[model samples]
Target: MDFDVDDAATLMALLDEKRPRRVTQSLLSGWDMLQTDLPSRERIESATAVLVGTGLATVDEDWGMLLTAEGARIRRAVPGRGLGMRQIPGILGAQLRARGVARADLTLPAALYDAAYSAYMEAAAHREERAYRRHWWETWKPRRQR
Candidate 1:
């Protein structure tokens, strides 16, 4: 399915927050960062679907998801409304890395970028575990012989 503008906007805002980026966490954290109420999970899920479908992000069974190069470019290009400087520079670094760049100057500090990315990876791992447990029985159900 194509990305609805509102969905894309919400995802962009979440990623813009000054913390590790995750579909749900970004939505929850956005409330504090933007001083607005949190968005519903449906909305976040819809946005995530678009991001994944459009190759703007990647979903990991062990990691939540992170913005892809195309996603980062879109986020940088379209700054969120009323949210000044809502682009994550590390995503830019990611964009470069995706293109096989050895080194490049980034708008964000290396230390801050490293911290946020690391935090995101950790969060993704936890999310993956929870998801696995949530559906473990269904996945491990004994298969009937054909």
Candidate 2:
């Protein structure tokens, strides 16, 4: 399938909107907090790389992933855009909350991890489906008892 240019553009626009805000939210977590959050893993990864490459976000020993000062400044300057948190899947939410670290300040690391992991899972499922469609013998073979 062709990549969705519109989806990518939407993400860019959202980031641009946040570029001048004085928000305390990390960009990744902020993006996740959007009601119009990115629709696919590809878009999430691509947008993330773009933000990191542009110095809007950086990997930090303290923060894991964080919006740069400039990024936060830009976000502040932009007119306030309301951000809404995406509802985590029930089981995933429970697991994360159970870990005793479910604070708003910690949302970025959780969001980044969730995005990458979800992308990996989706890609793996796609690969397995393709292999099944192609009639890969291993896909059809009965599993050996452990």
Candidate 3:
């Protein structure tokens, strides 16, 4: 599933160090806390829908919404978009700048870890790698078995 900037922003709001959160309570507040530029409520809701459809988020009536294990894993793996030496300072500056004026996409944060990540994922899909890992886990012993 393709995740656009809106989807990214929505996911950011939902993620609270792996804690469950009420959607209505967390959505706008997270953006404000992070000094993110305001996106329309509809936009945020739409993004949430996409995330749910992709199995990245689960909504519980009692506990609100939470990121699934896969969601959190993907989030952790997501690399910043433009985290170059010169860009680092600018990204920081933007975060501390005025909220609405701040461009949410600045520093191009997290367009998903595509380059090396894609290659790694592709390689991991091979059965040979899985077999090797399984064999190492099942057969390898640090000391001689008695």
Instruction: Compute each candidate's TM-score over C-alphas.
Output: 0.43, 0.33, 0.42
Writing each residue's lDDT as its tens digit, candidate 1 over 1-146 gives: 22233444455545632243643443455533443444444445555555566566665543355777766666666444654633443333344334432211112233433454455557768989999996886677778621
Model 1's number of clashes is 0
lDDT score for candidate 1 against the true structure: 0.49
Could you tell me how far off, in angstroms, the CA of residue 125 lies in candidate 2 after the best superposition? 21
Q: Once model 3 is optimally superposed onto the true structure by TM-score, how far is the C-alpha of residue 61 displaced, in angstroms?
A: 2.8
Segments of candidate 2 deviating more than 4 angstroms: 1-38, 60-64, 81-146
lDDT of 2 by residue, 28-121 (tens): 3344445335344445445444445555555443334445675445444433345322322222223323332211212234454465556655
**Ten residues in a row with the worst lDDT in model 2?**
99-108
Looking at model 3, the pairs that clash are none
**Which candidate achieves the best TM-score against the true structure?**
1
Error of 2 at 123 (Å): 22
| Consecutive 10-residue window with the lowest summed lDDT within model 3 | 100-109
For model 3, how does the per-residue alpha-carbon lDDT over 27-140 read when each residue is reduced to its tens digit? 444543354444444454455555465555665544255776765665545445744323332332232232221122112112222332344435546757889898887777
Candidates sorted by TM-score, descending order? Answer: 1, 3, 2
